[model samples]
Target: MSNQTSYDVVVVGAGNAALCAAISACEEGAKVLVLEKGPEHKRGGNSFFTDGAIRVAYHNLKDIRKVVPDLTDEDAAAVVMPDYHEDDYYEDIMRVTKGESQPELAKQLVNRSFETLVWMKGHGVKFELNYENQSYEKDGKRQFWGGLPVKTENKGIGLMEQLFTRAQELGIDIWYEAAAVELMKKEENICGVAVEQDGKRMTVETTGVILACGSLEANKTFRSEQLGDEWEAAIVRGTEYNTGDGISMATAIGAEKFGEYSGCHSIGTDYNAPKVGDFNKPGDIYKKHSYPLSIMLNKDGKRFVDEGADFRNYTYAKYGREILKQPDHVAYQIYDSQVRPLLRKEYDLEEATYYKGESLLELVNQLPVDKQQFLKTIEEYNDAVQGGEYNPTEKDGKKTTGLTPEKTNWALKIENGPFYAYPVTCGITFSFGGLHVNSSGEVLKKDNKPLSGLFAAGEMVGGIFYHNYPGGSGLMSGAVYGKLAGSAAARYVLGNKKDTKITN
Candidate 1:
């Protein structure tokens, strides 16, 4: 029998953004069909790999702090505001995008950020707000920041499941393994998509279509073209489904591309460097594994980053510089016994070749290294920490300054036993490269007009950010844009003036 499907709206991909778009469209009483390229409804495209931290203007940790006892407004805002807001956040966004990030579009995202959160709350996505009163996790173990009272939950997959359930209840049709191979355009407008279903070609027609097929992180062709030759060979340890299907389909129809921020990184070589767990922590949960000050060596064993900044941020900046200068473009993480168990508990740390020797001297004996140079590096760090000599990486802004053993909690006397070491390299997390869309989630062409009958959200669309990424911003953008794209698409379907696709 010949198979066919049609809908008022067609949502592509199975990531968080795709789920949200499908649910929202169905909730609005539109006939929706969701196409998942992956099988068995497994949530492993890109969203499954996310921390699921939602950033909005309302009911944020800051708002909760306002009602909580004994907390001042300034203090609460100071704590959470660093997370994100309009003025400062927008400046950072535009600065990295080099003013190419649509400012008008950014304004809407900033303004509606709080409302978007409220909308999700009205739905059922849970977050780590005022927790059930738990103790803070410090020393980089499964906790947030350096002892903030804030609670954090990482059930982003759970949120996507809820939205998908809502869509199912609304009678939205979801087709698994139904990969969209092409966009069906009628005249100058996108009318539907040609999706592969059960090894057969099928057409799904709609008045509106949303593209959320995710990024080119795993696509060497697209990444090399967008991020240059360096990222071509960069090991991608994450999702392999994001082959830039959205970008390719959009580009076929004259869509513009932006945001070459491909370099946001973390260590993901082995178990100690698992990219999947304890995401609430600043780094990838590896730094807190009782790692000593082994003088973070580059390919040539020279100190690069401060060894104190979150490894995620460290890897990004480090790889950006080191990859170009060195042939292999890698580094080594040296530590001892204390790191092994903690890294295991915090993550699947069994991925590394670990060693527990009688002493640091013995641990060094196992690995081929300049024993004298290693000893001198340790001695220099001990002196600086003992004498309180400031070893600041950046004098003006947030720099390492000094990593004094006496002052630091992770600073246990390394003069003890059972040493350890792990070879660490950068793990490519979310690729910031995506389609060019205004803040209102309208896909833009080179001429700056909204591509008629088309919209995009999530990591699949770009142009709002350029090179650097601020923490929590990318995930927040997905939620904000989902709301924007759905509501804007609804307006276009209802024949209203498309809102200015502007952002902060």
Candidate 2:
């Protein structure tokens, strides 16, 4: 640990958002310190478990080249990229959240997304086309969909590695196993942080504090109380260390709680996945995101949701809640040989929990669902599938005729042999409820006033998300607000140097 006990800014958490804040503060000539709740081995928080896909608005390949500068002429020519303007990005957030997203925060997130990625690129983060997850091969060209095309080179692990490298290069100090337990306040203005380091209590004096330590998805008590008792059974898909430390500490000091407390970013993950995220196997391997092309049957052997209501990017987050409400808190994604080639790579993992059979009868027998009802469900679904050009790149109108919860698009019949069924359960990624923040990322009090010396970013800053979220917008929001918080915190600290006093 560093012998110095004073800093201009102290950032809680070591994930992408916290690191961005640290680096940005350092660039503004502030001495910054970062605190990681977990040990050195488990550093990146939830960000390490992501696929690193970031959503941003861009016109075409030329705009993409601004972030991914190494794209060759041949590589660029092979893919058909579409234009996604700021209005489209803004609309997607509103559409997904059902217009519950705070307008100011949503606008800042959409407008600053591309420029934030560019700023991150200058700080040593790398980017490339997310072809594997966001594109489909059509007419001898890779056509990108979902308004998301860029990802970190090696996914979340690579993203954190680059951010850590840049933080080190900028002379930012990070102490692992240092968890912030309390926010030190001087009257109404913030002064320092009380941290638990190596099982010992210590105080770090700072003028500004950024709480980017994440929310309460990992805390079972919080989940049960806030999101309901059913959420207690939800598997955690990310770091176990983020157990509402930021929320509790901030709220204790009068931070206003905001956003949808009942909603979170949950998804169908492998049923056999560990109760908590495993560092040994990270990068979204537990997710089964290709359900849009398959029918998900509950234990009652019935379709619970319209599997193809929209693109997987739009529906995956909210579908997990429906799976949790099923009989056994489990659902099976059934697919046939015709669409076998379209499943994502996560389906083929050696650890995946799936059953394969040569025929429909044989497949239903292997599952715990009602065998008779399962077969009948498939029979009805097959008879309703309308014939059309099965296009995976766009919302093809091929749908079922009169199904109960109709498959609105990409409805393929389950008539071919060599079928597969994968068991999945709800895996909660992060909570949407958290501290309220303004467009400048300042944490607000109950009176809608900014808390002095306190700012927030990442999942801890709420109001940008609600019932559901767009595919790659979480990381983008973190970067945008993290940069804003860091810059604003630095200016706040420097401008108040006359009144700020550092004590060892």
Candidate 3:
């Protein structure tokens, strides 16, 4: 290893957010060093496991072309893309979080999403329309629903590969297996980081430190203590390395804790998924997000939640907690042959745990739930399904009536033969609670003052999410704040040396 022990900025973690910070700092002529807790094989954090769908506001096809320049006339003609304004993005965040999101941070995330994406494209990160996950063929035209449509070309793996390539080309030093054990300080101003690398402790001096090392979802003890005992059973859906290193190190130094401690981004994943995320089958393969088109039944064979209460993007994060609350923490997503074609690709994976039968009665009998109650529940659900033009691309008000929990949208009858049931349990993505930060991405002290030389990005910086989150917003917010923190940290180091004005 090189004997270099000083850098203008030291960024913890090598995920999308952390790499973005490193790249942004380098752009400002700052010598940046990146520390990854995982080995080289497991470099990226949760970002490598994501589907890479990033939500951004765009005016029309023209705006999308700014990032997806390969969209030809033929490609544009084949899809009907809707414009997602900043107001729409902001409203979705506030609506999903029940207005618990910090106003300043929420506004920054929404307004800067598009520009940050464009900046990412400039940094060699590829972009493409998320047709497989966000689009549906309706009226011979692929209509992209859910204000999110863009993703990295090959999802999370592609995203990280490109970022790492760019970082290497820029000559940024990255130390893998170097865990930041402590944040070194000098009279209350962050000065360096104490890292454990190759089982040897070392101090890396720096003018600023950016914490992008993720949150506490993978730590079972932290999950049980913060999210309640029921959450101890929640399957971690991302990197095992994100065991709250950033939160613990920052909090120990008087960084004010913020956001919903009891809340997290959880979802219904395959019942047989590993206790922690599997890098071998990454990119959200274990998650079953098509529940908006299926009826979720519990162990008692009763519908506990309105599966179609809203779009899956708005409700999927919170539904896992509801599943965990069920007896045995197990639920089944039931779908008929008519809607089977609408299910996401995760349902067909080899690792998926599901049962199929020619009819609803046969399928219910094969499931582990109460067979009699399961049939009765399906009968009641079928009887209540109202008649309307069923549209999977949008919320078609074809709802059910007279049910304890009504399916408010896409309420299709489970009458077609070849019924299927997939057993699922709660899969926790990340915790919502983290260090508080301002618009500039500076971590704040307990007194609400900016903590000098310390900044945060990605899941480490919280308050933009609360009880629930809009799908794709997590990555978008990470990029947005990561850029902000990197630029701010670089400016902090540069001081009066050069004009370090950042522009989109």
What lDDT does the true structure give each of the candidates? Answer: 0.56, 0.93, 0.91
Residue pairs with backbone atoms closer than 3 Å in model 3 (clashes):
none
By lDDT rank, best first, the candidates go: 2, 3, 1
Worst 10 residues of 1 by lDDT: 390-399
Candidate 2 lDDT tens digits, 78-195: 9899899999999999999999999999999999999999999999999999988999998898999999999998899999999999999988999989989999889999989998
lDDT of 1 by residue, 405-478 (tens): 22232332345456665555545555666778877677888898988888898886675655555444555677
Indicate which candidate wins on TM-score. Answer: 2
lDDT of 2 at 86: 95
Per-residue CA lDDT of model 3 for 278-343, tens digit only, reads 778878888899999999999898999999888888999999999999999999999889999888
What TM-score does candidate 1 get on C-alpha atoms? Answer: 0.76
lDDT of 2: 0.93
Tell me the TM-score of each prediction against the true structure.
0.76, 0.98, 0.97
Q: lDDT: which is higher, 1 or 3?
A: 3
